[model samples]
Target: MNLDPPISSSEVTLERLDPLSAAAARPVTTGAALLALVLPPLTLLSRGHEVTQPLWLIVSYAALGGAAWLLLDRSRSTRPVWTAPSAQVFQVLLMVMLVTAAAATAGANDLVRDDWAPLVVGVLLVASTPYRPAREILFWTIVHTLLCAALGVIQAPSAITDVPALTLAVTGSFSIAVMGFAAAAYARSLTSSTQLWHDRAWQSAAAAALEHRSGVARSVQQRRVSLLNREVVPYLQRVVNADGIGDDDREEARRLARSIRTLLVSDVEKTWAQLMLDDLVGRHPRLNITAVADDPDDLGRRAVLERRTLLRALAAISVERLSATGLALRLSTPEGRLAVRWEVATPRPLPDAHRELRSMLELIRGLTLRSSVHELPGRLVIEFEYGY
Candidate 1:
């Protein structure tokens, strides 16, 4: 019989959260895309300038809109391939091309003209902040800087001569790229820190549980040793000294043997629920316990483990608050659903008891498919339905 507790669902969720995956990255990607989509139209509108080729402006808007949709749609899927570096690179290149085409159609000589094309490109680059790694972000940032510089020089060859305007365009684009990279790095760091704290908490809990179980085992072993010394040891010593067994000695030996047998069989093949009830009865003789269950031997390993964990938690709560006069536990498989119902009545209200045993209750709920807790006057009832 395994006495170790099963891993709770909360632990599994925490474990999954620790690893950086597509699901974790989706929110940032989606947010960045939405921001980029909104900024371009707002930038174009704020500038209030007519383009030389209205068709090119329309095409650019359509391209940006399509890119945003692609990103938002892909983020909804959990597949890693959709968020791969290659996919991100392709999206970035598409954005750059569409922005450049728009700029070219606006007339390169009028690049320094009151147009938000450069700013739109900058925003597009920033949109990659959450999805790409630092090295990749750096590479793209440099790429955008060069693209902006080239566009400024092409729009006005004389702007190259006018270093101020040229410098402004290049520096502005570079700054936006750097800011995006910084934001992405900060976000990654925050996620890592959160996962680290979760892992530490789980480790601390596991260590505490281990120490508790070890202490319980040690205490039980000490009691067993004391029992043997008081009964079996003395009986054996007398038989050894006398060299022959008399009627009193025989009776004493038989009694000692029965005691040893009872001790050995105490918990050998009992279910966890049965063992818990026995312990509860021993501790609180006045408390009445009625239990009904399917044969534990018929249950699968996982079902048994889950049942044990649930019963152990319930037993602990009941034993600590001996206000209950009656405790009833029922376990059955009705219509192929494994169900458990526990009812307890106490002299006073246990309104705060659920809060005190919140963790245990959470573990029980996590193990089962569905469960409910009801507080009625002096009685608390909990029901759980689960599967193997």
Candidate 2:
């Protein structure tokens, strides 16, 4: 078997858009969206403090809601194209705005800030893990940490003087950064492992198929060698052993030469249509198998296999159920499509002939782009159209 052509860049991109990866990434995005939705309200309720700047708090909640909506919208898309770098940058900017808003809300009110917004920002970073590179993740994580810290310093300068408050701001932002890095690392590792397994499985299957084909070729070669020894070699040996040339020996030699010529010609590759007709006529000596073709060499390997399978099924039906003594195969290529028409004559209709034909036709339908089976009073016709 020949190896397929090298994959194009577009093909590689399409493969990267695996539905499994999209499915796995969706849950992470959805979870981040949910956290974004739930965490701010929880923080407000727990703090039990009046929001001095209600409008800023509203803006903060609106930003968080917008981020959540964006992520949820991307998750809904089949391919999840939001994992691109530009999209990630836009999302991270939104997260930064949300953090700044939260810090402003803390500054306006004398509330003990819990750093929930920064933590949620860290969680939102996981949404890009499936598509973005590790360096990109690391870069965004550092950017987010610095942005959160700067917002904290600007919004709550008094709180920064207290040791515990200072510790909370620094540690909280760095801890979130650590979590983001860990999530990105894990996602990358999982993707690598899954791809590795898929490649190994494909290679294993290809090797097994190649081995099976080699075995079949060896078997065919052995049979051909045995046939030559039995039919041609012995006659030649007898002629050589004889003391003198005779008319009888010459006649025998002529017959042997014809046999060898026929064998050699038959060994040449023939179109599937020709091969099937020869095989069917040989198996059923009384049966008439006619094959007509135009440009049979244009047929692809897959088309040939499909034609052979259909012929085998028809042959089996003729042998087992219908006493069909005649069959015709017409193969033609028109407008880049390969079309095959098969006609078989039935002497008398069997009780289950139509049912069996329908079943066989149904199986053949999968092998071709278009196929149809028709039954007349005493004949069945199958037409198949396929592409290279």
- After superposition of all CA atoms, the RMSD between model 1 and the true structure is 11.6
Stretch of 10 with least lDDT, candidate 1: 10-19
After the best TM-score superposition of candidate 2, give how far the Cα of residue 161 lies from its true spot, in angstroms: 6.8
Give, for candidate 2, the lowest lDDT window spanning 10 residues: 6-15
Name model 2 segments beyond 4 Å from true. 1-18, 21-28, 48-50, 83-86, 106-113, 164-168, 208-388
Q: Write the per-residue lDDT of candidate 2 for residues 1-388, one digit (tens) a residue.
A: 1112332322222114243455456676787779867887787786546455677777777777776676665444322234455457556656655565655555443433465666667676676555445556666777777766566555555453354545545754775577778866765665566557756865776676468557645654665788679966887788689888899888877887787677667546555455545545656667554433333563533453334455656666765566666666676666656676877777766336666565455444433435666676677777776522
TM-scores, one per candidate? 0.42, 0.48
lDDT of each: 0.55, 0.58
List, residue by residue over 42-107, the lDDT tens digit for candidate 1: 755644353556666667667667666765653342222223454464557545554654463444
Candidate 1 local lDDT, residue 58: 67
Question: In model 1, what lDDT does residue 141 have?
Answer: 56
